[model samples]
Structure formats: C-alpha cells, structure tokens
Target: MDIINEILSSNILPYVLLGYAISILVVVIMIVLENRNPLKTISWVLVLLLLPGLGFILYIFFGQNFRKEKIIARKGLRNHHRLNNLAYSQISQLTHGSLGDNETARQPTGIVRLLLNNSSSLVTTGNEVTFLNNGKDKFEALLRELKNARHFIHLEYYIFAEDRIGNEVKKILKEKASRGVEVRLIVDDVGSWELKRSFFEEMRNAGVEVYSFLQVRFPLLTSKVNYRNHRKIVVIDGHIGFIGGYNIADRYKEGDAKTYGIWRDTHIMIQGDAVNSLQSIFLTDWYFVSRTELTDPKYFPASQPVSNKVMQIVPSGPDSDWPAIMMGIFHTITSARDYLYIATPYFLPSESVLFALKTAALSGVDVRIIIPEKSDAFITLLCSRSYIREMLEAGVQIYFYQKGFLHAKTVVADDKISIVGSANMDFRSFEQNFEATAFIYDKGAAQEMKATFFKDQSDSEIILLPEWIDRPYIEKVKESFARLFSPLL
Candidate 1:
C-alpha cells in the first residue's frame, strides 16, 4: 500500500494528468466551437474519452476544421463570385427562354435550378454522353483520346497508382508532352502515397507538369489529410472529357482479379458544351494548386451542339458551405415520380439522404440501391449493414453485387435523369472529398444507366428483410459498434 501510494504521487503522474487535462480541454473546445454535426461531436468526444493519449493525436490530425480558411483562400484566388454571377446570369436566361421546351430540361427543373443556384453549376445543352461500364473500356477510350490530343491534356484523380496501367498512362502522357501537347496532372497525395518522387521523375523530365493536392509532409500530424481530392477527370484539348469512378490503376481494370474478384465500375465520356464545364472544374483545381490562371478563350473554345443531352457539372467539396452533390441527390430522389436506381460502393448516407430515400420509398416510388457484397473497407461494410434493416423495412429494395466489387457511383431516376460521378452515397464523399457529378438530363443516357444497373442486378443477391433481421447476434453487436463510428467514417 505504501509503494502504491508513492507511485501514485510520483512526479510523472502530474505530467500524465496534465496531458489528459489538455486533451479534455481540447475536447471541450471542439464540442463548443467546431460547429460540427452533433453526432460527429459526440463521436469525437467519445473517441477522446475512450482512447485518451492516442485519441487526442487522432483528433489533432482529423478533427481540426480548416475548411473555412482554405475555402476563403481558394475563393480569393479563383474569383468564385464572378463565376457565380455568370452562372446565375445563364440560369436567368435559360429560365425565361425555351429551356422548358426540351423534355429533358422540363423534367428535373428543380434539381437543375438547385445545382445552378447553390453550386454554380450551369446547365449546358447539347452534350453527347457515352457510358463506359468497366475500366477496360474506360482506359481504352482514354488512351485513344490521349493519342489524339492536340493542344493540351489535363488529368486529375484521387488514385494514380504507379502500377501497370499507371505506367502505360504515364508513357502516353510523356509522349503527348514530348509532342508539345502541354500535359498536366494532379493527384491526391494521401491516396497515391505509394508513388515515390522517382515514379514521377520520368514524367517531369519529359515536360509533364505534375502536382499533388494537399501534400502531407507528416501524415499523422496534418489537418489536410482528412480532405481529399476524390474527383477523376480527364480532358483532352478542352473538347473531350471523361469523369466518373475510375482511377488510373490496374485494379480497376477487368481480369486484374482483386480479392473481391473482377472490378466493376462506370465512367462517362462527354463531348460538346459540357466538356467546357468539366475543363473549367479542372482549371479551377489547377489554379488552386499551380497558381497559374487558365481563363483564356482557347481553353473554352466554342462547342457546337452535338446532341440534345443537357448536362450540369456539379462539383462539391468541404470548401463549399453546402453539400451540393448530396442536395442534388436528395432533390432527385424526392422528385422521382416513377423509379430510382442507385449503384455505389459505399452506402453510408447522411440523415437527410436517408430520410429522403425512406420518404420516397414510402411514397410508392420504386427505389432500389445496389452495393458491393465485399467492400474495401470492412468497418464501413459493418456500418453499412446496420442501416440495411431499416432500409429494407422501409420497402427500399437492397441488392448486393455478387459478381464483383461494384465501385460505380451512379443514379438513374424516372428514366429521364441520370447522375454519374465520383461522389458516393456516403457522408465522406458529401462532406469531405472534392467530388464532381454530371447531372445528365436525357432519356437516352438514363436508359443506358438503368440498363447497366439491371445488368449489375442480374449478378446481385437481394437482401430480404426477414433474413437481415435474423443475422447473428454477434454480427448485430459488431454492427452497433461500427455504427457508432459511422459519422467519423
């Protein structure tokens, strides 16, 4: 008892106590001043209280809110207000003119208006959209487009692996740069951290301008680590563009045979005025990183209408005050009069999205969601299962793809509206990552997406409510525990 007393009263105890007190103080400050979601606040507090020393370190890296400061800086650099004014002017002209005459625009007007107003995503008419179902097709088409590049090539992705496919793409990029094509590439530092500086030296030596978004010097001590650039965009000479869930990696290609089997995904190739919007998004991000303004008319060359497909390139990120992509999806679900089909790798949605989906299902709308049977993140899978019962009970049909891992983020509503992008049906995509989706107002595009969803469904196993409820008790407990971390996940 004497020894215990002495140890408890040792000088080391005071330093330990001080450390814990500082952690507690930080927790209090976060709860009081961060203005985060109540659930997230509780989650962070719980992590801090439970993990003690390590929790505070995690909080320092992930919990600090630098969005407002970074957003203000980006706004000042990009002149966002001028872009907003231009978008608003375009919206006014479209609203008063013959935009409603097109059936594609007549439907989903509210969603279009909301994106235009909130995200400054101007609706562009006359776009041709082609769906690429897998990475094989996507990369093939991308390579062809790269081979034909003339003036400039811009590419951005969350993951640009230094693997087989990545090397091939790099070879093409180097060749293009060598031919005076002005190639530029941006990748997320954290996602592609495996890539060494030497991996990019060859490209740099060949005149390719490479930059990493929000590079982390110290991975465990940086606030920027939480926010990632998740968008995958490819623009060839400002006339052709590709955007969707694909990254430059062999794992995305079919026959790569990952642990989950074949990889299934979706991407879209765009030609016409919509490519200009995609290029603008790339330029905005480019300016943020490279600090070289690219507002010349050469990059925004006039595009003649190729098709009747109306498109709005809606970009969302932590930089924005509102979750624009989530809001657009919510509006799409609420406005659906016939049916809604969704395919995403992650299904952990926000409360508003969950409410919207449940409301839509209960309103007699045919709502269906497809998720992969085996996800890359096991914790996210566990948390996703926690919501399966609720969604099933609400009459929302849930299907788990069995043929392969489904990484496509797609939605087709009422056979007249479609969305394809990098933003998943999850809070991380909505609230943290820089994502972009193409709001396509065309029955042809919607039908193609719906057909793809059905094709994916042919290989999926539907989860019945009774069977989901009868899952093992241990699994239920695991799900409950995982759900507690859903906000943070």
Candidate 2:
C-alpha cells in the first residue's frame, strides 16, 4: 500500500495521460488531413484506440505520409518534357493496345489504368534478361558493367553493406568518380543502418554524389522511419540496367553467409529500349532524395535498338494510392494458363493475394511456390507456413528450399511472361515500402527463368498438408496472431 501511494504521488500517471492524449490527437489530425480511405481510416482508428500508446507512435511514424507529393513534384520536374510525343504514343500503345486508347496491356482497370493515363510513359520494350544466381556472379557482372560505364552510372539499393563485396564496389565507384564519370548512389539510411556512414562519406569525398533516403534519428519525432526506398537498380551509360532482389552485401555471397552459406537471390541484366523505364524510375527517386533535377543529356540520351526482347518496368510505393506491385502479381497469377512459379524470401501476403493464389491453384493451374526452409526472420517464416497450408490444400505445390535461404523473387507464368525485382511477396513491400520490378514478355527469357526455378525445386522438399497441420499448437497460435495484423505488417 505504501509503494502504491508513493507511485501515485510521483506524478507518473499524469505525464503518461498527457502523452497519450497528445498521441491520440495527432493520429486523428493526420488521418483527417491525409484524406485516407474511410475504411483504412477506421482501421487505423481501431489500432490507435486498441493499442493506445504504441498505436499512436506507429501512426506518427508511418500513417502521416501516404502519398509523397513533394517527392513526386521534384520527380515530375526532372523529365517533364523529354521524350514527349513518342513516349506518350508508346504509353498509349502499351496501355490501350492502340495509339488512341488509354488502357494498358497488363492492367486495364482501376488505379493502374488511371496512373497510365495521367503519367503516360514511353512503353519501351525489347530487352534481354540474364539470371545472376550467386553473389560472385552478380559481383563480377556488376564490376564489369561499372568498369565499362562511359557516360554515367546511377545506383540505388536498400542496403549497401561494408564487407568485401561492398568495399570492392565502393572502390570502383570511387575510381570511376575520380575519372570524371557522373556517379550517383542512393541508400536507405535505415536499411543500411549497420553500414558505417564513413563508407558513404569516403565516396562523397572521392566525388560520388551520394544521398541517404529518409534518415531516421531521435526517438519520438520525425515520420521517415516507415518510408524506405527498397529499389535495387543499376543503369550504365543508359544502355543497360540491372534490377532484382539482390543488395550490395557480402551476406548474399557464398562463404559470406556463415550461418546459411548459400545465399539465393535473382537479378536481371536488361539490354535495349526497356532501359528507359529503369532510367525514369531512377530520375524520379533521385530527384526526391537529392532535391536536384538530374537531366544530364548524356545519361538519358535516346532509345536505340539494343535487343529484341519486350519488357516493362513497374515502380510502386506509398506515393501511389494503389498497391501497384501487389495488384500486378494478383493479375498475373489469376491469368496463368498452365503454370505459375514463384520464389520469395518472405510470404506474408495480404488477403487479396492469398485469394489470388488459391484461386489460381484451384482453377487447374500448375501453381508452385519456393521459399527458404529457414529464414532470417522466424516470425515471418511461421506466418508464411500458415499460408502454405491453405495453398497446399488448393493444389499449389509448396517447396521448402533445402539448400539455403532463398531470397530470389521471380515469377514465371505459362512460359510467356516473367516478372522479377526487389519486391517480396509480403504486406510491407506491397503497400508500404518503395519497390521496383520488371515484366518480361519473351519466350527465351521465360524459358530460362523456368529452368532455373526447376533446378532449385530439385533440391527443395515439398511441404505436405498433413505435415504442416501436424505442427505444434503453439506455432499455429503464433501464426494466427501474426495473420491478424497482416494489414499493418
């Protein structure tokens, strides 16, 4: 009784009450000010009311910025006029299937169609894709391309770790900068939190234009923590580009993952007109981060004949109201005629995605999903298991990669279309973080991607329904709880 009385007398309750009230007020103001969907607004309101203190904190960090208007404005300025008529004509052809129609070949309805109509891009195609499986292979190709860069090199990634691979790439960038090559690199401050700022500073000192995306600092202030740029792209001389799930970290290399050993991820080296899409994506993001309109004529010169493969680059994030990447996956999976192959490190999908996969499997599609038997995040792995149970019952073959962590995110459908990029099959990537991907419509590329998936499946153990259900009750409970927060995860 004496301790209770002392605690009450200490005035902690009053301070706590004051803080809670402030948070609630802020959350309400942000929701209303941002003009979010009524359904989503109610969902957020429930979170704030239920969790109280923690909910408000999450809202302050993530809820305030749904659309990055200021960032988009800067991006708009960078390439507002370049490639005007021809680009618009291409966009119309890709979207509407005709020069005058406004519908896209991939998505003909909803927000994506609207985005295509408003932001008419040059629907460039004809590119070749090469799968970079191992870190050594990826590093070698990256170095070779960087060394051959003549005009400029634009690079962006979530994590740029400072290990052997990172340092090697860093040294090249430094050397290239010294040679008067216009080098620009952007890294997410939080994703690369472990990477010492000194590494970036060294690059800056060596003449590389470096910028950090949404640097997080302090405890209770700032809303930059939730908005992360998770796009990995490399454009050299505006002639070739690489986009994929890999990052600049030794952790992705063999003998580098001391715990897992073989790190698996997929990257594509694109050649031809499709490079323009990647270039535009970089310019938009660069303008947002650096606040400088980057329109050096040498970088985005003109589209020339490089390859005969058809490809489309898709970029999505919080800036756009529609969940572009997630919707794209859903559309592709639902449209599969014969086979659907998917590889992802994480599988925490939204309700719509879950439905799409199940529908495809039940509709007689030979659906298959490959995921890491063991993951860096145990909670996510467990949640992924829960989804697999449903998919298995729906006739989807689920494989647990026995080799090591499978971080590659590649989707091949019907041996005609393929999609690959940094976006994972999860809620965070689908709706929250910024992501980029490439859609390919080439027989050669699709066949090669399918072959690689089959190779990995040979070493993977298929997950049986009985085996998944027979797991411990405690594990099931954890998954159920994790699933309940799918929207916010």
Candidate 3:
C-alpha cells in the first residue's frame, strides 16, 4: 500500500501521464493519416479513447496498414510483366467481341475486361468445373486427383489439420513426393498452428516440401496475423485444379462435432486451362514462401480445353492493389438484368458491396442471399444479422440456412455469370486475406449454380420485413453491439 501510494503520488507521475497522452495522440494521428475505411478508423479512435490500454495493444496488432511496406506490392507485381502482354492482347480481342462465343458472353465480357485490366485475371475457355457440394464429396474428388498427380502437386490452404482427412491427404502427398512427383504444400502458419511441427515434419521426411504462409513467430506476430492467405487451391500437374471454401480439416468432412449437423460447404474441381491460372496462384505464393520459383514448363503443362466453360480465376487480398472480387461483384450486381443469388458464410460486406446489393434489389433485380442461421462464431452471426434489417428494407430477400452452417461463397448472376471460391462477402476476404474466386461466364454452369442455390433455398427460411422489424429489442441490441466491430471482423 505504501509503495502503491508512493508511486501514485510520485513527482514524475504528471510527466509520465503527459507522455502517455502524447503517445496516444500520436497513434490517433497515424490512424487518421493511414486513410483506412472511415468506419474502421472511427472504431479504432473510439477504442483508443474509451479503452486506451487494450485498444493500443489491439491497434499495435491489427490497425497498422501493412500495405505501405511494399512487400505485398512486390508480390502482386511479380506477375504483371508476364501477364501484361497476355492481358493487353486479350483486352484487345475482348473489346471487339471476338473472344466470346455467343450473346450470353456479351454481358459478362465487361467483367472479363475489368479483371484483365485490374488483376490480370485472364479469361480461360473450355474449362470444366464440377461443384463439390460438401467437404466429403470435395475430399473424395481431391484424393482421387491427388492419386493421379503424375508430374507435381501444389497445395495452399488456410487450415491443414492433423486429423483423419489431413492424414489421408498427407499420406497421398507423401506417396506422390516419394515417387518424385514434386509435391509442395503451403499452410497458413497461424491457421494450422494447433498441430505440432512434427505433423509437417512427417511429410518432410517423406520428401514432400512443406512451408507456411506468412509465418508468425513469437514476437513478430502482429501485422501478419491480420492478413492471412485464406485461399484454398490445389493444382495437380497443371491440368487438374481445385478451388473453393473447404480447408483441409475433419470438421469440413464430418459434421462439426461441437457445433451442429453437417458442416455444409462448397468446392470446385476444375479441369481445363483455368488450372494454369490456379497453378500460377499457387506458384506465386510458393515463391513468396520458398523463394524458389517453379516456372518450369512442367509446372504449367499445356492443357486442352475440356469444355466450353469460360471463367477467370480472380485473385485478391492486401497483396493486390485493388479489391478485384469486390469490384467484380459490384459490376456483376449492377449488370444483373434478371436475378442474382448468393451464398456465403460471412456477409460483412464492404460499403460498395452493400450498396450494390441494396441498389440492385431496389432496381428490381431479384437479389436473394442465403447465410448460415447459426454461424460458427456467435459474434459473427449477430454482426451478420445487423445488416439484415437494412437489406430487408431494400427488398432484398434474406434466408437463414437451418440444415447446417452454409459455408459456400458463391454468387450466381443471371444465366451468364457464376462465381465460386474461397472468398466470403466480408471485409476480411476483400481487404485482408488472400482469396481466389472463379468467375464463370457460361449458361450451363450458371444454370447449374442456380439449381444448387434453389436447392439450398428450399431448405432455408426466408426473413420477411415485418417479422425482422418486430424482432425482440434485446436481440437487436446484441447485433447493434456486434455491428460496431464489422469493419475489423
């Protein structure tokens, strides 16, 4: 008590307090200068002022704009030189309508040009895309492809658990690597941190080269922790590829034992020229991780177009200069003449996306969105619900999936555009984490995606405006509180 009193009453206390205030002011000034999302900036300011101690720590970890560092810029620009000519030539062809097959392609060719100019996301045709509805089907297909990987296997995932499914996949990777198939894996350091190093070591012993994306060591955890590589990509021999929301974990295959019934998810098994793009994305990340570029002709083997499916494997993140997927979705929504259906686990959309949805709905475009009734995160669920009232007011139909957690990040715009990938319609997906989505411009594929959406819709319960407005005040309070963190979520 005497020591505490002496410290509290010390003559230097005033100087120390002044220094602390100055420091906080300095941080606030930095946040303002960073020019972050206005909402995020305001949230950070409030946190620092209201809870200085905790907020400062949180700011130190997440609020810092790592984009200014230019490492991600370098990573993003690596493909520019190579893709520039291809993009330019394609843009030239696309502008004249020689690139597309039919009038159905006329509408979304704008999106193709946008992606081409923005992200070098080339439009590849004759790619066959098969939707893997759940994790079980995804894995079965993935394993089958893994077994047939004759040349090389490249995989990048946010989560690669050390469970039954992980072991099974690892076993195949080991077997392939042993046969000189050149297997490589990138698991997000933080996402897969639960497993012991030995888990990966076992694969290493079997000759599989494994590395982590944005490895977060003890004290250097900040900054990187906020920007994750959330993409789930698997390229086998540059001919067969897989991309979607399912990470390598048991819960995705078997139902979430702790949460509820089947953990419903969506993935795509792609076979065509699009595989080259998928391969390129994996190699780019692999180069970032291993510093060894795999640009051999074997890595991107020549693939004959398997079908008439036209698509672009769009990639985006902090590494990207522009929010490609977000912008693309905005354009897609605005261009929708008929109806647009979406399925995503998280729906904390950026301002542009939210505006796009509301505007599209208001403009008489039938916009239907399906999200999990009870998401894995309670706070996230409430945060998602907070946007519902505004959406419902705009006449956008919102449905809650009661069967299970619907973790499919998909957007089907009219009969010409079908988007599916690892990206959720959220700030984390658009602004922070690395994501890759295939924007398919095809009638057959779009129709198939619509059919899938309708099937899921049948199982979902729609929210009417009256019922949503009449919800209990306590629930609204929880959602209101959660909404404050939407930008950071």
Evaluated with TM-score, which candidate comes out highest?
3
TM-score of each: 0.95, 0.87, 0.96
lDDT of 2 by residue, 428-456 (tens): 89877888988776677889999999999
Candidate achieving higher lDDT, 2 or 3: 3
* lDDT of candidate model 1 versus the reference: 0.87
lDDT of 3 at 316: 89
Q: Model 3, range 1-489, lDDT digits (tens) per residue? A: 998688688997788778889989999999999888899898888889888688889888887877556445444434545666787888988767677566425546778889988788987877898999987789999999999989889899999998999999999999999899989999998889887889778889999999988888758878688888999999988889999999998989997756767788889999988998987788778878887766566776777768878888999887677888988988999899889999999889888889989999999999999999988888888999999999999989999998888999999987989999999998888888889999988888899999999999998999999998998899999999888888888
Provide the lDDT at 308 for model 3. 78
Candidate 1 lDDT over 1-489, as tens digits, reads 987688688877788788779868867685769788887888888888888778888877777776676542556544455668878886886687645345444656678779988789878877899899988799999999999999999999999998888999999999989989999999999889999989778789999999998888765446788899999999888789999999988899853464888899999999988898888788888987888877676887888778888889998997776789999999999899899999999988998899999999999999999999998999999988888988988889999999879999999999888999999998889888899999998888899899999999999999999888887899999988898888888
Q: Among all windows of ten consecutive residues in candidate 2, which has the lowest summed lDDT? A: 100-109
Which residue pairs does candidate 1 place in steric collision?
none
